[model samples]
Structures are given as C-alpha cells and as structure tokens.
Target chain A: MAALNIEQIALDIASPLAEEPGALLPILHALQEHFAYIPTEVVPGVAQLLNLSRAEVHGVISFYDWFQAEPSGASTLYICRAESCQAMGSAAVEAAAKQHLGIDYHQTSDDGRITLQPIYCLGNCACSPAVMLDEKLYSRVSAESLVAMLDNLPERES
Target chain B: MSVRVYVPSDSTALSLGADDIARGLGEIDLDIEIIRNGSRGLCWLEPLLEIDSPEGRLGFANVTAKELSTLFSDGVPGSAHPRCLGLTEELPYLKQQRRLTSARIGLMKPCSLDDYRAQGGFTGLTKALEMSCEEIVACVTDSGLRGRGGAAFPTGIKWQTVLSAEGDKKYIVCNADEGDSGTYVDRLIMECDPYTLIEGIIIASLAVNADEGYIYCRAEYPLALERLQQAIELATDAGYLKHFKLQVRKAAGAYICGEETSLLESLEGKRGQVRFRPPLPAIEGLFGKPTVVNNVISLASIPGILAGGAASYQAYGSGRSRGTLTVQLAGNIKRGGLVEVPFGLSLRQLLEDFGGGTASGRPIKAVQAGGPLGAYIPPALFDTPLDYEAFKAIGAMVGHGGLVVFDDSADLGQMARFAMEFCAVESCGKCTPCRIGSVRGVEVIDRIHQGEQVEENRILLRDLCQTMIDGSLCALGGMAPFPVLSVMEHFPDEL
Candidate 1:
C-alpha cells in the first residue's frame, strides 16, 4: 500500500468526529492514537478542518499533559509521584528508573527508545509506588524491581 | 461437577500479576473453567484465586504462575493448601462490613451481560422503568444518599435542580475523573461492575428526563475506560437500554477536571479551568444546557437504592450521613484495599480492624482522610467517625472516603510541601489564591524547614492558607489549605 499522507490521515480520522459537540478533544485523541502522539505538522490542517484557530488547537494540546506534541519514542514509562507512592518511597523507584533508562520525565533516551513521564495516580494505590512500563502495571515496585521491569522491556519495532 | 476458578482482572490485580497466573492455569490439563472476574476488593490477597464449591467462593491468596498447577493438584477447595484463604465471604475483613454499591464486584465477570442479568443486574433499572420521574427523584431524596466524591453534597438535591430547571436539552454526566492519590473507588466500580454504572446512568437519565448521557472517565484508568465503553456498547446492543443515548468520553490527564465544572469545560474540548458557581452545572452545564453531573460512586449507588427501596439502602450510617461508604485504604496500610462500611465507623476501626494497621510495622503517625485537599489527622484523633459532619466537626472532610495512612517514617514537612506542590501543579490557573498561594506556600514551608525566620514563615503560611480558603474561586483553591493547616496543627515541630 502507498504511504498515506499525514494531512489525509488527520482528515480521515477527524471528519466523522467533527460533528460531535466538543469534537476537538476526541479528534486529537484519535490522531494521537494513530500517530502515537499529536503531530505538529497536522495542527494547522486540523484547525482548518475543525474551524478552530491554530492557537486554540495548540492551547488545548498543551493544556492536557497526555497530548504530547511530538511522536512518542518506542515506549513510555510512568512513575506514580502521588502521596501513596511517596509513603512507599517512589522517589527511590523514580531514581532507579532514571538511572536505568538514562532519562528523566518528558525526556526520551539518547537513542529514542523510551520516554518517561510522571503520572499522578493510576488508582493502584493499594500497591504503592506503582509504575506502568508499556502496557503492563507493576505494583510495589522497589528500586530494584523497577530496574528489572525496565530492563525486561522488549526492543522497539523499527 | 466441573470446578470453576476466578482471577481478578482489575488494575490492582493485574499490577500484582493476575494475568500470568490465569495463563498458567490455562496450560493445565483440567476440566476447570477459568473466569477473569473483577477484584473482590481484597487487594492484599490478589491475585486471589477463587474456586466455586457447593458452599461458596473459596479463595487462595497471592497465587503465582508456578503455583497454579500445584494448587489445583492439592485439591483446591477442601484440601488445606497453605495458600488457601478459606471462603472469601467469611474472611473477617470482608464479613465485618456492608458492600452495597460494590456488592457485585469480584463475584461475577466484569463485562458479561448474561452474568450481570443473572445476578440481579438491572433490577433497579427494571423497577425504575415503571416509575415516574417525580417518584424516582423522591426515592433518591429520601434515601439521604450524599455524593461519595469528597464534596458530600446531596445527590437528590443536585438532580432536583436539573429536573426542575427549564432547559432545551438536559444531560447526565458521570465524573469518572477520579485523580485523587488515595481514592480508587470510582475505578473499582467502573472496572469491576461496569454494568452497575451503565444502569445507574440510564436510571439517572430517566429520572431527569435526559435523552443523552456521558461518563467522562480519566485517561489514567485505561482498563476502567475500556470496560465502561464496552459495557455501554453491550447494554446498547442487548436492548437493555434504548430511550436514552449513552457514551464514554475520555478525559486527557487533568486532575482539576475531577471538579464538575472543570470536567464540563474539558468535555467541551477546552482548557479544564474552573467555572464560577450560582449558574451551577445543574442549571447551565454542558454546552450551557441543564445537566446533572454526579460522581461515579454517587451515581453507581442509585440502581441498588431503587431496587431495594430508599429506606433499606438508608438503613446504614448515622445522623445526616446515610447508607454504606466504600472506604479505600491506601498508603502504608497492611491490608490495603477497599472496605464498604457504614458512615459512623471510625478511622481507628478502618485502620486497625480492616486495614490491619501500617504495612511497615511502625505506628501510623498520621492519616490523610479524603484526598490531597483533605486534612491530615494525627493518631490522637483516630476515633473520629467516618461521618461527613463528624469529619468536618474536627476540621476535616471525609472527602471521597479515602484514608491514606502514613507511618512514623514519613516526614511531615515534606508531606506538607508536597501537598502544596500538588495544588500548585494541578491548580488550573483559574484563580489567583491557588495558583500563587500554593507556590508561596511551598516556599514558606521550605523556609520553616530550613530554620530561616521560622516563626515569621509559620505566620505567613497560616495567613496564605486562610486566604486560599476564603478567596479562591473553586474547591481546588479553597480546600487546598486543609492539609497545610493539619500539618501545622498536629506536627508543629515539622512546620
């Protein structure tokens, strides 16, 4: 199949949802899901298609922490920094992860394999200091356990 | 008889590795059918494997993948495997309380319509189907059921406003944006019993004369969102729901959106900044139409209230606080999980009897009742009951019924600072007091901690907190001072 254009992809994903009230958020979500993150290149096109100003679209994208402006790396690592995790010493877990991955929150590794982010709560408070590496949720993660989990992540498909 | 086994598929259970155990069971050559059910709220014992016997559900605690075959070979139910936790219902922690809103969690499949209907699933909706909107509203009002999402406002009163309000189109929105650190009750209901929520929303739509509804769940809870979306689709497909239209809208990581107005703003695909009151969401809510925005727990509890009469549901609790509360114990607690009890039960009982005290084996120095915005209660005041009025009487609100415990190892200064920092990070920038007071609050606490003008800083912190309390536009700014003040009152040395 010929490669689909990014503008076409944005239009194809957003057209059906544009009619819904407050359709921008849903459209952004669909675009992010297909592209792994919102593409800045499609911002102007999305604005034109949705009848929103480019600034308004950008403001919405920037307001929510989930809507990253660039394409994601191979995977994203989320470390819980809320009170429950702090009680169980998430600082240590976070430290170990940063040391292991050689990256901090919002920073991709030098080779671009992983992007780290700080999530407030994943509702896994029962298992304090929870971290979601890729799609898996690991509980009661000590520094050592988090490192092991991070290391176990499979290589990203090129 | 073919033996059946259940493994929880909730986030906590999955985090503790339930899927691997199920896969391990799947590999075994046995007639036993494996069912992926929601957590029984016995979180500490997950992945708690349950077997169906002639008696009831027998449980096994923390079963690993390797132990699956051995557990079955040792004769699962009657045989005394070391991992056996006995009949799950009889377990002292689960048996000592009520499970009104959470009755169906852990017992059945998370999204199975057949299982849901078989286990009295739409009974309340079926009953509600025959009632008038006025009668439905009256039943909720009589139930004395308040919102479980921190605010403790009367659910019936909020609905009454929307029901009576003159608007072109009314909407029912479920605030599933449960971002509080210690609370997961909303996520539990959505994940464990999605049908309950679906039924509850439909009933709400019926009572309010709303033909459209939305469940604005946080993107934080992917599993809950996925299940709720699937449940809505399933309910729609099965013709269990028709008159009302329902949809699950995903919230993009905004903690302030948990506030109903901010949530409405976010739902409109705008910045999740707080909107002013008087023209409450009930009057001019989503898209400026009359809307009823209820928390996940408050709405989810409706089906049971309707099916079992308001008084029967109101039989629990004392004073103004009626009905059972689903208290989620987090932080350093040993028996960390969800406990549904009456409102009058004290934090002492929940912390000791249900939670089994701190996991670190140290005496719990403090407990943050409610969420980040809630006050920190020292051990001296452990006897304070879980009533909304009772908590407020002692300068704390039972906000969302989440008690996050902290042992002796915790640094109150850091905890205090973090509370301010959390407010600062999530303040939505709508008002000045929260947006600026929080950052200054953190600096003042730091100065006090560093022994620089300690006395002056303490005074300044107190002054700032009072300003945030009195002047802020929304609760995010208004209630953020509770934790700061609690730290100052109880742990003077730290501040």
Candidate 2:
C-alpha cells in the first residue's frame, strides 16, 4: 500500500458528495473502496465535510459489518452461516475452515493471508454452504474445497 | 445462423461455476452466441444451459468445463446428448410454474434496456405515464399485489396512502435488502431482469408522485448491485427514466434494515435501528417525509400487473392473494430454485412435485416456510395451500415465499436454537423482548437439548415466546418464536 495523504484523499472523495443527501455513506464507501478500510484520521475530515459529528460518522461506520477500521487481509472469505446453509451442513464447513485456518469468524490469519467473515445469505440457497472470496462466489463449498482454494490463492502480507 | 446458447448468470448458477462455462464457450471457435440470462429457477439442473431450438430452448444440466468440448463436438443443440433435458418448458418443474413477474428474467440480456423493451418491458411505465396517480393506485389495489417481503400488506393500499399523503418530496424506496435465508428471487430479478424492477420503480414513483427513488440493495450482492447500476445508467441515458431520479444505495450488513423504518434509518447514514410505527413510512418516512417503501418483488411485479392489467393479474391468484408468488425452494430440496406460481398450490405440490422431495433421498421430516422467522411445518401438513391467509390461519406466514426443506437427518432442536440465535445476532436492540428474549430462547432450547429440566425449560420457552410476540416492536422479535414453537409442537422427538 502507498503512503496516502489522508486529508487530500478524504477531501477529493468527500468534496463531491458534500451537497448530496446522506453523503456520509458514499464518502465512507469511497474511502473503504480506495483504502480497503476507513482510517481513524479521515473521520474528522469526513465529519467536517459532511457537517456531522465524528461520533455520528463513527456510529455509521461501526454499525455496518462491511466497513472495517483496520486494513483487511489480501483475501476475504465470506461463508454463509444462515439457515439454508446451516441446513446443508455449513456449520460443519465453517468448523472445518476455522480449524484449518486456525482463526474464528471476523478474524484474519496471522500471515494476513485471509480474513474469514460470516454472511447471513449469499442468495444461493439451492447451492448451499456458499462461500465468497472477494467478488467471486463459490457454492457447494465443502471444508476441503475451501481449504484447497485458500491454499492456491496468491500469498500476500498485511 | 449461430445457435443462441442461453446460460444463466444468476447468483445461484454463478455459484455453481456458470462463469467458467460461459468463459470456456467464449474461448472456443464454435458458431454459438452465448446469451447470459437469469436462472429459470431449476437449481438442481443448473448451470442449466439452454439452446434456442426450433422446438424451444432445449435444456442441459450441470454443464462443467470438461463436458463443454463434448457438448460442442456432438453438434451441440442439433444432436441428441446424454445430458440434454429436452425442452426447457417441458421440464415438469418449470412447466407447472406461472412466471408472470419473472417472465423476461431468463429470456433477455439483463442490463440491456433494448432487450428489456423488446420483451414487453416498459409497457407498464408507458401506461403509467398516461394514467393518473389515483388510477394507478387503484389498478394496483384491484390487482391485489401485496408486499412480498414477508409482510403481505397490500402494496396498492400502501401506494394509495403515499399518493394521498401531503408531502412535497415523497420518495419511492425499493427494499432489495434481501437478508432472508433460502430466498434468492429478489436477487435473481435484480440481476437477471433488472429492467422489470427499474420499470416497476418508475411506475411506483409515478403512482406515488415521488420523483426521487433509491434501491437499498445489500453489499453482499455485488453482482446484483453491478447489474442494477448498469441498468440505471442505461435507462437514464436512454431517457427511459426521465420522470424519476433513481439511485442504488448499498446496505451495510443489518438484518433489521430489511424492516422499512430500520431501512430508512440506514438510508439516512445512521445505525439501522427499528423506529416506532405510529408515523408509518407512508405518512412520514425517509428524511421525515412521505415515502413509498416497497419490496423488490412488489415493485418488480408492478410492471407485469400494469402491462397485463389488474383484472388479468387478479384473475390468476386465489382469493385476496392475487398475483403469482415467486416461491423459492431451497436447502435440502432436490430441485431447489425459484418457482413462480399462483397462490393456490399446496405444500405437497411444492415439496414433492416441484422440489422432487429431499435431496438426500430420505423422507422430508420438516419444511420451514417463509424464512427463519417462519414456522417449521411438519410433513403431516404438506397439504396446506400456499396463501397468506391460509398460512396465517395455521400460525405461519408466507414470508418472502421462501421454503427450506429438511430431510430426516435434520435436528429440529438445532434449527429451533438457530432461529433464536439468528434473531439475537440480527436484532436492532430497540425492544427488550427481541434483544434479550432471543438470547433467553437460545438458552432455553440449549437447556432442553442438554436434558436439564427439559419440561420446565419448555414451559419457560413458550412463556418467553409469548412475551416476545407481545412486546417486540418489530417482526424480528415477534416471529422468532414461530420456528421454536413449531419445532417443539411438531418434532418434539427431534427437539
């Protein structure tokens, strides 16, 4: 990751959306997309631009599971833990992944290779126990397949 | 002429490696035109590749990368193949369906406005352009379209309220925050037939006198979000959306956000907390103004209702549950996918005829209708017809019309525990019963499972459920007990 001037980046992102209704989400989304996480330093800049309290911005950011405070691992794996997936033994799949990765949900590997998160549904109930690595969705994902997929991913450091 | 090979780009199909199939076919030098369409909802047979034959779209199931070369070599759709499933409509699972709202889903290019118009797409909006707001609301009221997002409140009535409400800047917000498990129909439509939803939103905007709109799609559905953004851009550029300004907002993960008030709060860039309902959304919503918040399906169905006319749409369904229900078959079911049909169908027909029973080849022990909040109906009540009133009569809701099948291998006790856990995890903490009672419900179920004062815990569980039902502000707490109590009532042995 490049060394970013937080003030400049936040201004560039938040300036355009300043006039829009409920501009906080868009500003946050832009920051998250560009940096992969919302840095604490950008909070004051966003709050100043949007004229919202830093606490309000923080509240919004913290409420959403999508918004992260720290930079995530190179790859994020979202495993559906909802009812349909649960029915098709996703619990077992999740258990196996946690065991293999040696990390629980919402936690990253020590090497910062992967971040595991629990999703409610992937809207792929027919193909139960669905998994998503970033944008790509994989269904019928058993623990073995997920582990293999993780192993093959290009190694990266946080 | 090149053969038109339709491959589903729907999430379920994509999850099953449909992208690989599409890419592999594109790389080949074959004279085949690949059309990425939505899933026909026959999930077991996906990635269901269809060839536009003279007879109709001939179907092939589970087409993998290895089979692609063989499929092309054997004259493709022209020759007989082992994997071929004959005509797409002839498949008993699809043939029995009455796909009105989903008519153009699997047949057209999802993002192309031209393709959408070619398939009777914006006819409703055109008709709506001519009609008065009251007339439009009346047409929908006559059509009897209800909220497909769990609550079966009449959409037309809601629209009428929003239309009549005195607000200078009313809003039409489409709830695409499809957090329900075993439900993919909304996502499918938004991805496969986005124009329908866009057109429906336009019609809704026109009907409610709301010029500005926002589609609150969840962040989990990247593909759906992408497709919708594309569709909106094209529609905007083409001047098809001149009447209304539309924008898609990504909903940060919150199950309570699916609730209208919570969704409005989230839209305002606040924590998705449930709001008190004396000032209903129709009167004062979305920035403290009158808002018409409709589900994706409820809005998507508007175009169909308008194009076909209210009487024609009203003619299809049974009783007050007018219009077809897009029932999602999921979980352990064999043919799990979207099944759009009139509301008169029985659970037996949905489970046995459409679902092909349990995927495990074991007898189905239980089925959870609606969603996680729905009751776990025992196999004995398979004959129960799929109607809002009928389902309500049996202490169940046809919530979002998602049915998850469970064979004998499933433990109802675990499912009951999960229902409580889901509520606890997703609750907005607005009310005590939902926030605290869900935790207590899980503890009681766990205690019962551990054989520690089982009868006493069961009684305590029932009492807690009643309190939650009575005390909770929203359906999250109120309906959490349905699954628990149903599991206890029907499958006490499993519990």
Per-prediction count of colliding residue pairs?
A: 1, 0
Q: Candidate 1: misplaced stretches above 4 Å? A: A1-4, B75-79
Model 2's CAPRI class is: medium
Model 1 lDDT at residue B124: 96
Q: Which candidate is the best by TM-score?
A: 1
Error of 2 at B78 (Å): 2.0
Residue A10 displacement (Å), model 2: 2.4
Judge candidate 2 at residue A156 and give its lDDT.
64
Q: Which stretches of candidate 2 lie over 4 Å from their true place?
A: A1-4, A156-158
For candidate 1, lDDT tens digit of each residue in B383-412? 988898989999998988888889999998
Restricted to chain B, the TM-score per model reads: 0.99, 0.98
For candidate 2, the per-residue lDDT at A77 reads: 90
Give the DockQ (C-alpha) for candidate 2: 0.77
